[model samples]
Target: MMYQLGKRIESIVLPVEMLQQLKPSDFPNQWEYEAWQRRNLKILEAGLLLHPLLPLDKTDTAAQQLRQIIRGALEKPLETGKNNKTMQALRSIALSLACRTFDGSVSETSHWADGFPLNLRIYQMLLEACFDVNDETSVIEEVDEVLELVKKTWVVLGMNQMLHDLCFLWILFNRYVVTGQVESDLLFAANNLLMEVEKDAKAMTDPDYSKIISSTLGTILGWAEKRLLAYHNYFHSDNTETMECVVSMAVLSAKIMVEDISHEYHRTRKEIDLARERVDNYIRSSLRVAFVQASFQYFSIMSLHRMSSTR
Candidate 1:
């Protein structure tokens, strides 16, 4: 029955129309939502088997260990703000915890050589791609080639650590760049920075150290943004609004980092800005009319509330 239900769910990718109407708060209890999540996870697991391009492992002990680590890490960041720093910390913690839990002896044996360099390289490549939109065609093709090489290299090296590192990197990049946050360069840098910061924090031994780690990293990222802006004229084209939008988004990302470290305010405003840009681009391209219509309806409702309040 579980397998059948999972298969059914896997056959359907829920439309944006359906997702827009969902409200988790409407659920009666935590158990109800958990059951939904478990079903969804099963569906995803099953779908993985059908994909020719993706690698799958049925007895993936590392994957099982990752689940336990993620549960613990998710709890830590609830009180911390939902900013970039906290998100990255949670990711790093989960990766470390997963390694420790999966193969306890191996985790101790390969502590320093696992996650850092791979995370750094991934971040660097992503950030570089954010700005390169020109006659430089086949960029994505090149990236895919490099990724294949890296995958092959990992197999040759016989290290499961690369798998965990890449999984976290993929999740973080997808969440911020491919889905939520839209400023490609900033999203790229932010994802990388989070991993880098987490690496540094792990070395600290002071009590109440997480706060110190978060604040210090937040400040450094903010400083780096300013440096990038100071040299922006050298890198950006004058007439390119898309590039301008990317730069603006990067600056806004720093504000999110600050909010996460200090808990000063929510950074939803920037997210809304990026969403607006994406929506406008979609409308211009006529690519997903249903999504555009739903967005318009949402905006109309909000605008009506504003006008009615003024009256």
Candidate 2:
């Protein structure tokens, strides 16, 4: 397949020529082939149309034209044969978008797959490869080897160590969540990694990196806050082991967002106590909720007793 195409060849992907020659029989079944074909097209849609590396011009018909072509393909899959007119047009516009840059210069470097969330999503998928295939909840022993392969993709994805740390943080957090949140070690690992991200957040200045880190940290913080904001509601004696890591992460992510990403917090942040404030809020809110629930249950029981006496 494309001569084992050397990795990170200036963002080059499966060429239009190779795509044109593909057929359904080449795969194990029609469904698999169609899925593969649809996926390739969607990748093009994501990279070129949805999230190209550069700011897309609204006046550029190439984007609109590509959108229409993809939409039509969705309704009716297009032929990929060499002589197909649709394939030729798809190749042209897709390349045009992939090759365009901010400075209006012609360059061989394609930015197709190097966009913001798209690159992050691709990196996350690659990160998932670290998990054991047989035991989806567990990590493979060869994670270092898999990570080495992942780091090589950084060249293609326009990623650096900082972004890698952030993605790895969320990946671990998510795996912990999806695996029933019993694995406190994953939470611990994510919190430790987040310490590195906090340092990176302080020093890194790239806008793209900022945008991604903000969203990624926001997501991690959002999930953390839900549990921490009412720890009594969620955590119990049976599952209190993960609470420390959760609270630490929640507070750290909040501090990072406030100190690094938020303009409003610049002057007042140093005076504000993130940990103490968060813990106080959680305790007060949870106690108020519990008190209200208890009152409601007591009143309901009294009303039921009165109804029994009247009967």
TM-score of each: 0.25, 0.81
Clashes per model (N, Cα, C within 3 A): 0, 0
Worst 10 residues of 1 by lDDT: 10-19
Q: What is the C-alpha lDDT of each candidate?
A: 0.40, 0.82
Q: Which regions of candidate 1 fall more than 4 Å away from where they truly are?
A: 1-112, 115-140, 151-243, 261-311
Candidate 1 similarity to native, TM-score: 0.25
Model 2 misses residue 265 by how many Å?
2.0
lDDT of 1 by residue, 196-305 (tens): 44444334443333443444344444443443434333234653553454344344444334443344555576555643554355334443444566799999999999
Residue 122, candidate 1: alpha-carbon lDDT: 37
